[model samples]
Target: MTTKTEKVEASTKIRPRIGRWEVDDHNEVALLGTRCAACGEVAFPEHQICVNCGSESTEVVRIKGPATLRNYTIVHQLPPGYERPWVVGYGEFDGQLSVLAPIVAASRDELHEGLSLSLCVGVTKVDDDGEEMYSYQFTPTKA
Candidate 1:
């Protein structure tokens, strides 16, 4: 005899804070970026024009994780509606484009330049409407 498996559907469908990042049908999160057809340079937030060569031939592309931590710092003072004392840093992806995002680490000792980081999405803050705002962050790679 075999046991039957049951499928549970999500009660509520979640959406991203910004449409740039989205969870695909496979439940995989991907950051949307723009690539210049002329110079082959990529830009985040899906640029309409290429910032490098000023080319209008920009195409939207999916940028996947495994970025390197170039630099980071702990922010003591935070803006309104933000959780204070958060770590912010820049992660270099595709060996060219560096994206600034929150860094999630257990301790500062686990953070350093050239450290491997994987992109992840999580709730950054709650809006006045009580909606959960999501943002991308870089977490330490697991060995």
Candidate 2:
């Protein structure tokens, strides 16, 4: 089966929304996080200050996959430069951090809280310049 990163690499003009993620040599996408040396808090998007302990010293770390979906809602309306009728939800990873991300599913009925989900690299939208904005989204795990 084709992986998410392989789909991303197939795109002609794929660009990440932020610099916090990248596709590795194996075509697996990984997210960069900041782990505080003082409190061992891991913060996504690699923040300078630790959200848990407010520590200024932190190092970049890779976040693993297989997060659990806590909750979600179908968005009928979309923001500027985005598509319509998408799912957004919060995913809890490692029991320490809960992150809000786009929930990608075959249908809205397939989404629910406490569902097992995993990170997938996908195109959120195509900009006016025709660049595909690659970002992370949570998808229901296959049984």
By TM-score, the best candidate is 1
Off by over 4 Å in 2: 1-19
The residue ranges of model 1 lying beyond 4 angstroms of the native Cα positions read 1-19, 24-27
For model 2, residues 19-57, the per-residue Cα lDDT tens digits are 366656665556778899999998887888998899899
Top candidate, metric lDDT: 2
At residue 35, give the lDDT of candidate 1. 90
What is the TM-score (0 to 1) of candidate 2?
0.78
Worst 10 residues of 2 by lDDT: 1-10
* Model 1 C-alpha lDDT per residue in residues 1-143, reported as the tens digit of each score: 11011111222534432436656565455688899999999898777889899999999888877889999989988766667778989999868789988888637788889999887777676766675666777788778
Per-prediction count of colliding residue pairs?
A: 0, 0
lDDT for every model?
Answer: 0.74, 0.76
Candidate 2 at 23: error in angstroms?
Answer: 2.8
